[model samples]
Target: MTETAVEQFTEHQRKRGKRVSVVSPLDAPFFETERGSLILGDCLQTLKSLPANSVDLFVTSPPYDGQPKYGNGEKYERDWYRDFFMAVSAEILRTLKPHGSFVLNYRSKRRGAERGVLQYEMIFWLREQGFLFCEDFIWGKPSPPPGKFNRFLKDAVEYCFQFSKTNDWQFFPENCLSPARWDAKDRERRKKLAHNYVRANAPSGQGRKRVQAGPDMVRPSTLLHLEPEFSPNPVKHPARFPVELPSFFIKLLTQPGQLVVDPFGGTGTTGLAAERLDRRWLLVEIDPTYASIVPTRFENGR
Candidate 1:
């Protein structure tokens, strides 16, 4: 879009009014819970209209290049994917607050006969554009669906690339610690400790893991294992990230009431996670048919 086009779109959005979405102010049912609202329309247009630095966290699994569309039946050919990604990612960067982060879920392509390395080029692209490279996690699917017998097990993992707009970003570790327990080895080791030393620290007969503070402090793993749920929508999108994907990231990245945006909000999984987390959300869906169903699914969840 040109300079004039962007300016015009921004102006139009400022005055788009409550009617642009199905947000019903007077409807008690809609406001019964504090969950954020969902909008229907093209994500590119919706994202462009958003105020700069308005979002706290951006997390999404944009449709894979040349892959099947979710909610919408269109197919994206591989040739057009790179240019497509660059455009969308740039807009996402623009919408994010300086202290915010973007968690992108993507799969590496199996383009040729030889096995390829995990794709990190996109990570470099994001970093060069001023987003800080935080960490890269591998989301491992313990029970992945089978693929053709001719090759190795179908790629059972997806990359979860985390980027921060600023050096200091939000991360809470106390929220994710496992309870300390007394294993057999710990119990045996305790028997040999000096009497006074054991007496003071072993009251509960459990050895607690020392809590540490810093960047290396218990950051969540990139490899996530989540069970896929059945979707009522007859036509399923080929690759869909689990709701746990967004829920986990949201918990670690933002606080309640912070806004989360997903430029590629397919089936509103990100919004669903945001709602459960008590966070505000703004979603963009280009395919009207898919856009319409998102709110319906939320309003009448199965």
Candidate 2:
């Protein structure tokens, strides 16, 4: 947009009592590439401009309920978090397509070296918002964060809470299938058997392997074993997640050319994944510096 157009747009928003600073990206700094857009601004406010039921998938990790770990995150207690998510999620529910999926990756914060009920309280709040508790998965961190407190060991896992508008949301399980588990020695025995199975392991512990044929196939478990990524120039963002992490869900939950959104854009991991998977993405990052890093990532992500 032209400078004059931006000025006109800014003036128009001011007449409606909306703060232009929070919406500056609507004019100039809002950028778009072939596969995605990188908007530098508050996530909740940006959702208002998007059309309803436009997004096919939302794969993001919020501010850990306003924890102090991230630079912009504020330390808030359970009650505050419950209400905060209630507000932000209403926008998510609105923009999400009828069969879209909202994948929230979040973990509870520790308080004074002790555990709290923040995670539970927040889950209850999400459920109350009329979002279906579709399925809960674990993001298993192979390398956990160092323990600084006395109460617990190193933090190794976090929840990937899947929320759907309804139970009939899109899910392509075949996209995330894992290699079938088969012992090298057992392969020869399998060639002679049809629908091989160790029926002796049943509850009765007496059933034989006499069933029909079964294929050598398997799929990923609810537990996703992915680790954090290391960038030579991580810039100001230290907790950058790997691109494969988002790619997994993008492939499973969305099809090519569909819209995918990441409210907490971070290092543009989700956006890059969307690009590789032939999907379009809309990403928002509150920190301008982090948001600035997104475009370059699409060009030379390494």
Best prediction by lDDT: 2
Scored by lDDT, model 1 comes in at 0.66
C-alpha RMSD by candidate, in order: 9.1, 7.8
Prediction-by-prediction clash tally: 5, 2
Q: Write the per-residue lDDT of candidate 1 for residues 106-182, one digit (tens) a residue.
A: 87566567543334666777677777889887888777766784666666777888998888778865555434545
List lDDT for all candidates, in order.
0.66, 0.76
lDDT of 2 by residue, 38-102 (tens): 77677878888889999999998766544565565565556556665567788899989999999
Pairs with backbone N, CA or C atoms under 3 Å apart (clashes), candidate 1: 42-286, 66-76, 137-222, 138-222, 138-223
- Index of the highest-TM-score prediction: 2
What TM-score would each prediction reach against the true structure?
Answer: 0.72, 0.80
Worst 10-residue lDDT window for candidate 2 reads 1-10
Instruction: Assess the local accuracy of residue 274 in candidate 2 as a C-alpha lDDT between 0 and 100.
Output: 93
